[model samples]
Structure formats: C-alpha cells, structure tokens
Target chain A: MKRVRMRRLKVEKRTNPSAWTVFCISLVSILLAFVVIGFIFLGFGINPLEAYLEIIIETVGNSYGLSQIVWQSIPLLLCGVGLLLAFKTSFWNIGAEGQLLMGATAATWVALFSPLPEPFLIPAAFILGFAGGAVWGLLSTSLRSRFGINEVITTLMMNYIASNIVLYLIHGPWKGETMRGFAYTDQFPESVWLPTIGMSDIHWPTLLLGLFAAVCVFFILNRTRLGYEVKVVGQSPKAARYAGISYFKTIFYVMVISGGLAGLAGAGEVLGVHHMLRHSDQVSLGYGYTAIIVAWLARGNPLIVILTSLLFGAIYVAGDVLQLSFNLPFQIVNVFTGLILFFLISSDTLLKHKLSFRKGE
Target chain B: MKKAVLFALCLVFLLTGAIGLQAQDKLKVGFIYVGPIGDMGWTHAHEVARRIVEDTFPWVETVYQESVPEAKVEGVIDRMVRRERCAVVFTTSFGFWEGTVAAAKKYPDTIFAHCSGFMRAPNLATYMADFYQIYYLNGLMAGALTKSNKVGYVGAFPIPEVKRHINAFTMGVREVNPKAEVHVRWIEAWFDPAKAKEATNSLIDAGCDVFAFTEDSDTVVQVAAENRMPVFGHYSPMYNSAPDYVVSGQLVHWENFYLDFLSKVHAGYYTSKNLENVDYWDLLKEGSVEVGAKFGMPVNPKWKSRLGKTYDLVMERIAQMSDFQMVFDPFTGPIYSRKGAVVVPVGVRANYGHLLSLEYAVKGVVGSWPGEPK
Candidate 1:
C-alpha cells in the first residue's frame, strides 16, 4: 500500500482589519499591478519605469495636466460620493450611468428649450438634472421594491434605454439646425455656461458643489440616525426589522440621493465642460460606471472619495500621457486598469478572510 | 513599508521624468484620431499619411492619440498644446467639429485644422479628401461586373457625406447599366465589422451580386470575396484583402494635404489668425484622392478583363477627373431622384455646396433614407 499525505486548508472570517493593514494591502496590490503592467510595457518595447515616470510627471508635475485631472475628478467625485451612499445601503445601483444621461437630457431641456431667463437657466438646469436622475432611479427602485426585481439587471438595462432616448432626441426634434446635417445640438447660450478657473476646463461651481456634497454625505453617513439604520438594514435585514428600521425605505432614500448626485454630475458636464448638450457619450464618458470603482476603492467612505476620485482622475490623465508620449496602445491602459481593480478586489478578500494551511500525515 | 514603497516609486518616477523631458527642436504636430491607428480605414489612412509626413519633413515630429471620444477632444488638444508643446493639432473625423472649434477658440495661438467639418475659426481650418469621384469610378466597374444588375452597398451611416458618395456612385452605375439598382443597407455605425458583414449578407440575400462599401474595416470586401463576388474597397487601399474580386477602390492621399498645410505653416506663410477660409477641398486634381485597386494599378488586372466595355469608360472618367479643369463629371446632370424629382437639371454639374449637404437617394437605390426631404 502507498502512503498518502493530505494537506488541509482553512479559511476563517477576520473580525476586524485595521486601517493600516488595509492601506498596506492596497499599496501591495497597486505595486503588484504596476509590476504586471511593467511587463506589458516591456512587451510593447517601452521601458516600464520610464512610462511610469512620464505618467507621473505629465499628470502631477505639469499644470495643464493637474488642471485636467481636477476637471475630470469633479464628476467622479460627485458620482463616487453618491455611489458611496448607495453601496453603504447595499443597493447595487449600476444604473447611475443611465441616471446621469437622463439628468443631462433634463438639463438640455432647461438650457435649450426652457423659457427661463438667462440668469435663472443655470440653477434651473441643475434642479432639473437632479430631478431627472432621481426620477430615473425611482423607476428602478419601484421595480425592485414592488416586484422583488434585481436592481443590477434593471439598472444596466436602463443605461441602454437612456442612451436610445438621447439618440432619438438628437436624431429627431433636438438636432441642431446649424450642425450641418451632423447629429449634434447647437451650442448652449453663454449665460448657462459655468465659470471656469482661468484657462482650464475645471468648472468651479460644480467642483465646489462636489466638495460640499462630499462633506454633507460624510456627515450623513457618520452622524445621522438614518446612517445607523442604513448600516443595520444593509448588514442584517432581520436585525433592522427587530430594531424597527424599514429596509425598503432606507434603500429608497439611498437610491434617490445616489441617483441625484450622479445627475448633478451630468448637469455639470453640460453646463461646465461641454457648454452644449452634445452626444450622450460626449457628455458623460461613462463617469457614472467608473465611479463604482472610485467608491469601492475608497471603501465606501464619502470623505475618502475626494482623494480616490482624484487618484482615478490622475490615472485617466496618465493613460492619455502613455498614449501621447510612448505611442502605446489604448488597450494597454485598459489592461492596467483591469490589473489594479483585480488586485484591489483580491486584497479586499484577503483582508476579510484569514487563510491557513496544515500538513496531514 | 508603505513609506518605503512610496519613496522607491517616487525615485523611479523622478529619475525617469527628468531623463524624458529633454526638449527637441522639431515642430510637433499632434493628431487627434477618433478611431484607433491600427484600424484599416480612415484613421489608418491618416496614420500612414502621418508616417509619410514625418519621413518627408525633417523639422516635423508627430504624436497622436487614437480612439479619442469627441468629449475628450478638448482635453487631448490641451495636452497636445500645453504639455507636448505641439505647434499644430489636427482633429480627424466629422464628429470632432464642434470640440475642435471650441479648442480652437481656447488656443488661438495654436494652429488647428479639422477634417470634414464646416466650422472654421480664425485659428481653425477645415479639409476633406472626398471619395465621390472614386466611388463613381468604382460604381462604373460594379455596374459593368454585376450580372444580376443589382449592386450591393454597405453604408456606415446615411449621413450627407455618405449620401453624396452613393449618389455619385449610382450615377456611374446608371451611366453604365441603366436598369442596375444600388441596394444599400445602413449599419448606423462608422466601424462595426459584424454589422458590415451582416449588411453584406443581407444585400446578397436580396439578389445583389457586385458590392461596394464605406466602413472602417475590410469586412465587406472580405465577405463579398468569400462569396466570390466583386467588391470595391474604401478609405485605404484594400486590394491585398481581395485581389481577385476587387475591381477598383477609393484611396485617400491625406499626406498631400498634411504636407501642403505643414509646409505652409513651416515656411511662415500660414499663420494661426489666417486659417479662417483655408478649406482644403482637394480632389483628384490636387492628388488628395485616388481611384485604384492599389496605389499604381487603377483596376485589378483580373477584374479589368471582366469589366470589359466599361473598363475603358472607367479609365476615361479617371482621366477626366484627374485633369485640372476636367470636362466630365459623374454628376453631370439631367439626374433624377428615385422619387421622380430632378435633383440635377440638364447639363448642370452638382457644385461643392450642394454636394456637401446632399440628402437624396438617387434612382435605383433600394432602401430607406433617413432625413430625406420631400
């Protein structure tokens, strides 16, 4: 008879991981991502170290690059802060993208078609944008609460529907008469345009709003009774029920705030960046979807989202740098993003669970 | 350990950034492409032309960002101007018109040019290497080659630019085969290969034999040839993909405009403030567009024998188009819309403005045209 040896492995739930451990793990994951991407750079005949250096210098060291990062981060910060609330409530609201588009469409109506006077246009656009996104979110929430439908599928499907709505508008009644047969809208009036911080596309009104919203959300999540109920309902429905917290109500409010914030981002894109409601893709660039990564990376803390949003913003600017300077392919940047996210999620798993192996004789 | 990693990472970046920022004297020209450079159509043609521009001018250096969305156009232009110190930036694709216009306003000192757009600022110029003539030539060949008297067209979109090309092509086909119908199917996208293939198959199913297409990939050409049908290539020369079946194709020489524009910029003849009216609508006479299966060959030898009588007509048409003041044009009038209205009156050639905003389907076109006027 042959002797057989077995090695047993065990996984145990870790009660608590200190912030320091999480930071270290995140750092390790990021470094590991860079290492893998460095090999990818090598395959493309570019010096990986050189590529990293160029990205850093271009994004942080250069004024134009830094401004663009902040400009890009404004929407992300807004969306991420909103997503932080939704994630904390444990509602996987993937429809933020659709909500953002609907918000933009609503803002477009205010800017282009509204009879509002010049000075009132900007404020009205934001209000309409928020309402637009909130209403869109409510549709999904109602579906979830009434039919026990999964928000994930509904949210994702709504994105396509929202996109088609914009397409129909542009290709039909909203098509610009001055766009020379192209399917784009005429430039929004200058009064509706947001003021930018000199020479950069960093629209200050939206940026200030994002910072304000971040602080407000941070307070709401940490200081309020609703925050406590949200945590209870998300973590344990039975515990929440016993404690007299309504699951449906908590999720509904969270969905409203989340979708509204994303809508503000859409409004910002129209008023601040585009200054004209253009194609849906031209307005948002999937900032709402990317904000999921932003929120997750910040560990659902709205305050941390400020830093996380800027970091993702820098990564985007850096990707542009790699392509501009090194002639690197765009797919390589996508691979780089994929690696970071993969490692980050894996690290999260490691932080939550302890693994042990034993040799058996 | 975190601090140590941060420190090491910073050191690597600082050293590399320091080593990389050394300034060069070459006039950097940045290209903002709406599609990836690796693509086989419009972007690829421009990429190839950009390469030739780099080779032709010693003082010119080129950098480009591919797959840039229209939303990111201004941002890319900012980087190209502020970070990369690019003296000139060219925004390719029709969708980039408005963004390029806005960027042009922001950076008045930087010379800007937009392709296939009507909007032009004092600092922004517009240019297009249209394929109406080339398509007309290809249509003649398709008209001659199709036994079923039905030519299939896989269109990227039903936009005016495409409509203009199709009209000119149909005119050529009608000139050759009076009863030949040009069956068209719109993919509603500029660069989807699967859609192009399906559209091609759909046309084949509709009893059309010879094929022509305006898409970013060689899917239509490959698909048509797979079914042993003759097809015409668009944008870049795609003779290699289907040498036996390809009769002739529309080829762009974007380098001609790039070189001309850059040389003028290099010589200080064209300033940023003076480009308001610099619309480069260069055709065959300016060597901006070519009619050929490849660079040198006007028609595939294999297909030339098959084109038979219309082979001479195609050659004659090219000769007429390539002339400085050409006598003949495919759109030489007495042309009627498929709806029985005369689009072009007797002996009146379609002028530039009318051609640019075309929205009519010519006779023998068998598909729905969106945005058609009554």
Candidate 2:
C-alpha cells in the first residue's frame, strides 16, 4: 500500500507574516523571559507578579514617572538613530559611545574656554560636538575603508580613548581648584544650559531634539538618494558597487553621520539633563551599545527606533520601580534584558526555520 | 511532531517544578553596587560589609551583583524583590535614590537602605559614614607637602558626599598652611583606572605636587607616585595599592557597620525608625575609619611631619568622641560656592541637613556643574 506523505511545515514561507505576528512573538518572548525570571525571583523568595507590576508602574504609569522615562530615552533615541543609520548601509559603527565622548569633550572645551555669548554658545557647542564626533567616526571609517580594519574593534577601542581624554582634561587643566580629592570638572555655565520648556519636569528641548533627530534620520534613510544607496550597500556590497556606489565613500559618510549624531547626544546630555559633564559614568548612559539593539529590533526604521527606544525607556523605568518596590536585586533587569534580547534575536530563527521532532536523533 | 510536543511538555514541567521549589525559601537580601567588587572603593566597601552579614548570621541569606548603571538599576532591583523574594535590599549608589524609594513603597514589607542619601520611607532608611573626617587629614597631608602649595583632588561627582569630602580636605589643607590652595579634578566616575591616572597627570602638570582622590581605584595615587608627587588616598587603605606616593589616606571599615546593623536586624531591632539612629560613625580608634598606615617619609618632607601630626590628632579626637558627636563637620562656615555664594560664614558650622543637601561648588573651585541640578 502506498502511504501519502504529510507536507512539511514551511515556517519561512508563510502565506504572509504580519506585524501582529511579530508583536505576538515579541510579547511571548518577553513573557517567557519574565516567567523564567520569576522562578529566579522565587528562588530569592520574591513574588513574581508583584515584581512585574512594579516595573510597569514605575516606567509608564504616572506623569512624573513617564516624564523621567522619556527624559532618559532621549539619549538612547539619538544614539539609536545614528546606529540605525550605519546599520542601514551595512557599516557597523559601534563607536557611537566613543563618538559621544568626543562630542562631550569638545563641548566641554567650548564651555570652559569659549567666551561666546549665549546665542553663539549653544550653537557652537553643538557644532563642536557634532564635528568632534564626526571626526572620531571618520577616523574609524577611514581605517576600515583604507586599511580594512574592523569598525567594531576600532570603535570599541576609541570609546576608551575618548573617555580617558575627558578624564585627563577634567583631572588636569580643567580640574576645579576646590573639589576635594575627586577627578571631575565643574558644572557647565548657565548660559550654555538647555532650558526646560513650559515649566514641566521634562526637558522639552532634549525630547523634541531627540524626536527631531529621529525624523531627520527617517528622512535620510527613506527619502533621499543617499538613503537608497545606503540600503543597497547594506543589502550587498558587490551589488552596490555594480550600481556604482563607492563603498569607501559610503562607509566614510555613514560613519561621520553616525558619530555626529552620537556627539549631539552627548552634548544634549551635558546641556539638557546633567548640565555638567563631570567624570561620572552618567554622561551618556551607555546608550550607544543599547542603541544597537534598538536599531536591530527596528530593522533600521527610524520611527520604529523611536518606539523601541521608548519601550526600552519604559523597561528601564519599570525596572527601577520594581527594584525599590520588591527589594529586587538590581541585576534582575539585566537578566530580563538578556532574556528579551535573546528571544528577540531568536525570534528570527523561529521565523526562518521550522521546528521538527524525531523519536531519537 | 511527537518530539515537539514532548519538548513543550518538558519545558512546562521544568518551569513549573522550578517555581514550586522556589516558593519555599526564607527571606533574601539584595545588594547592588555601581562598580565591580574587585575595585577596592565604594563597591568593595559594601561587598565586605555584605560578607560580614552572611558570615556572622547564618539564618540570614544575601546576594549581590555589581557594575550596574543608573538606567538599569530599577530592573535589577525588581528581579531581586519580586522574583527572589528579597525582604530587604540595599542600593549602594546615590543615583539609586528615586528608584529605590519607589521600590520600597511598592514592597511595603521589604526594607531598603540607601547609601549616602537622605531619602526615606517607613521601610527605607539612609546609611552613610563620615569618610570626610579622614579627607580632612588627607588634605592636611596635601597642604603640608605641596612644593607649589597647589594640591590636587580627584573626585567622583559634585554630589554632597563628594563635595563634603573636598571641603573637608581643603579645610585640612588650610588649617596647616593658609597659603595652600587645593585644585580639584572631577573624574565623574567611581572607577576608571586610566581616567583616574590621566587626571593625576593633569593635576601634576598643573603644578600640583600633592594628589588625592575619592575614586575607588588607586590609579590616581599610582599616577602621582609615578610623577614623584605625594597623594592622599580615599576609601580605605589605598596605600597598599600605591605604597610609594602615600602620605596617608582615609579608610572605610564596613564590617563594624554591617555587623551592627545585621546584629540588630537579626535581634528583631531592625525597624526603619530604629535604623535612623543606627547611623554608625566608625573612628580611627574604633578601627572603623583609619587614618592610613603609619609610614616612612612622605614624598615631601613637610607632608611627612604634618600628616603624622594630623593623623595623631585625628586619632586622639576620634578616640575621645565615644558618642560620635561634636566632631568634624566638613561644611563649616566661611565657605563660599564657586559662584561666590557664601554657603557658610566663618565660625559657624553647617547643619547636617544643609551639608547633606550640598549641590553647588565652593568658592575658588573652577569648572561648571553639568546637566539639570542648576
């Protein structure tokens, strides 16, 4: 007797994959991560539901809380946009953090030395910040373009260099004459400070500027010929070359744009949130690294990057609430983050490959 | 198909079994730090104290993770409390304030102790030490030893804790030599070795022959020593970290403080109200705060004699103050903000509340405060 064979599940070739499916998968991943974390919490003797709720409320529940969450997301959005820009053209610019440090260092220099009036000060600070970051980015891109250096390594190394340079500046020449035995610079001048809009707890300038940055990136990535070229390069370097796009120039241009955005983020942070770029690790919130995830999750879509950033911001806010509310170990968020990112990445595997089972393989 | 079903079943069973087992543990204590435990500064100090609690009290269990960022702090705390069943938590950084406060409120039964902060709730309390007392003595060494009379300080942040230490050190410097002027470089981070070293070099180049720092790593001291400059160390016996550049340094003995708190908590005396008065001020005599290891000649002769004398005096005073009262207050009067605001008039001591609330730079301090606390 002839037996009919059942059709294999072609997970990769679905009738059509919808946004809803992606959303469901992400939600499931988050839930699964939470459940596993909940067990870990149970081992610590904590109530999982209470912990989850605490995170949600802290991150997005109330006005003050939401304001803080969004306030923190500003830097992430800026970095994420820049990273997304590089990701679009297959140019991995992991040096946004370093670039940010360079921007901060330059802005700090102007803040300390430039006697520009308030009007000129803000613009000059931003220009200097952008230029500084762009320069740092260009160096890495040029090395990659010219010497074929891997940008990931170069950018990572540059972060240390940039941060150390700031460290040296604050400690040596810019060291305040009276700070006890610390290694930080004094506060930025009031004239150069970012103004809070409408008497709100939120710094409107940073939020708006971040949104503006997102819009600008969206335009560059979607509306312009450069954006189209970037997509082609990202898809296939050889194909892009056949299409007459110069990989070296594209790499250099994207790196500069990415680094400049990061620089603006650093400047915004110094001018908007912290006002003074002290030696504190609070300068840029490691936004550059996290933005990689944001860009990837958004698939290099600038608008999606903004939303992803907000989601991360919410998670950050909620994590704090849960920590205080539940006496949760601060690392719990890291575990959650690890889980989320893990699942987010794995979701692609699920989408592309069908799971099969055998009795003994 | 059958294997897939089995895999799903196994996953469910494992998750459920794990949950069932975790439902039956005793209370957990979660501790968080801003830096790694390897760094012998803020994180190390807390870690040592945590070990004391774990070792001395067998019934109590505690766990900790280090090198957390401000943005991620809240989530870490959540996992510790909700999933781990932590009845108490300790956040070791000042940035943990708003997050910790919210956590304490959400988990009313859980207790929280925030280091170097004043925020509180019925279940949360504030805990910190008088590390500034040692800073004053450190300043004395910097003041007495500086060939250029320009001493440099490397700090973490301009927060009250750091600001107070700077003021105390400056006062110590001034007490010995009125002509001495302290220069401060803020590294803005608790631990970044290269940065700390770079700052040290910067100060050394600025004609500051004496160096000191409030950072966790001893790179600053090492940097000063490399340049043949004298340095006063902060947070514990950093002289061991830099044996060459040491005149003296401030030390934080966390065992006693942790022992006292854990003992009281174990004894059922750990309510937040009682914990308020449980603020411990460990002194040199009590072996809580040390004035550094008595050593050979300081890099500079003036520093050697002056540090010895100041260390002895501080030790003597600390020994006599059994009640932890009427001692050194860093924000004493005649203090001026860098913006020229008189923070405290001369001959007048600052109130604890005000000093703890310090937000501005003192007069003669260079540089600007960043971000939003203007």
Minimal lDDT window, size 10, model 1 chain B = B16-25
Tens-digit per-residue lDDT, B1-374, candidate 1: 99998997788766755643643578889999999888889999999999999999999989999999887888888778876888899999888876798888888899999999888888899999999988888888888888999999988776788998988888888889999999999886788999999999999999999999899999999999899999888887789998888778999999999999999999998899899899999888889999888898889898777878898888788888888997777777888888889999998988988888888888988898777778
lDDT of 2 by residue, B237-349 (tens): 66665566677777676777667766666677896444444444345445566566332222234344546565565555444543356455545678876567777889888
- Cα lDDT tens digits for candidate 1, A1-361: 8778988788899878888887888899999988998998898899997787778777887788899899989999988998889888888889888888888899989999999888899999999998898889888899988999999999889988988788777766787777766677777988888999998889999999899999998898889988888888878889999998988899888888888988998998888877666667767888989999999899967888999899888888888888888888877667877899999998888899877898866
Candidate 1, B323: how far from true, in Å? 1.1
In candidate 2 the C-alpha lDDT for residue B149 amounts to: 82
- Name the regions of candidate 1 deviating beyond 4 angstroms: A1-13, A223-226, A238-247, A354-361, B1-24
In the range A159-223, model 2's lDDT, one tens digit per residue, is 88887787767656676544432345666778887776543335566677678888988998778
Residue B228 deviation, candidate 2, in Å? 26
In TM-score terms, candidate 1 sits at 0.91
Query: lDDT of candidate 2 vs native?
Result: 0.71
Candidate 1 CAPRI level: acceptable
Q: All candidates' lDDT scores? A: 0.87, 0.71
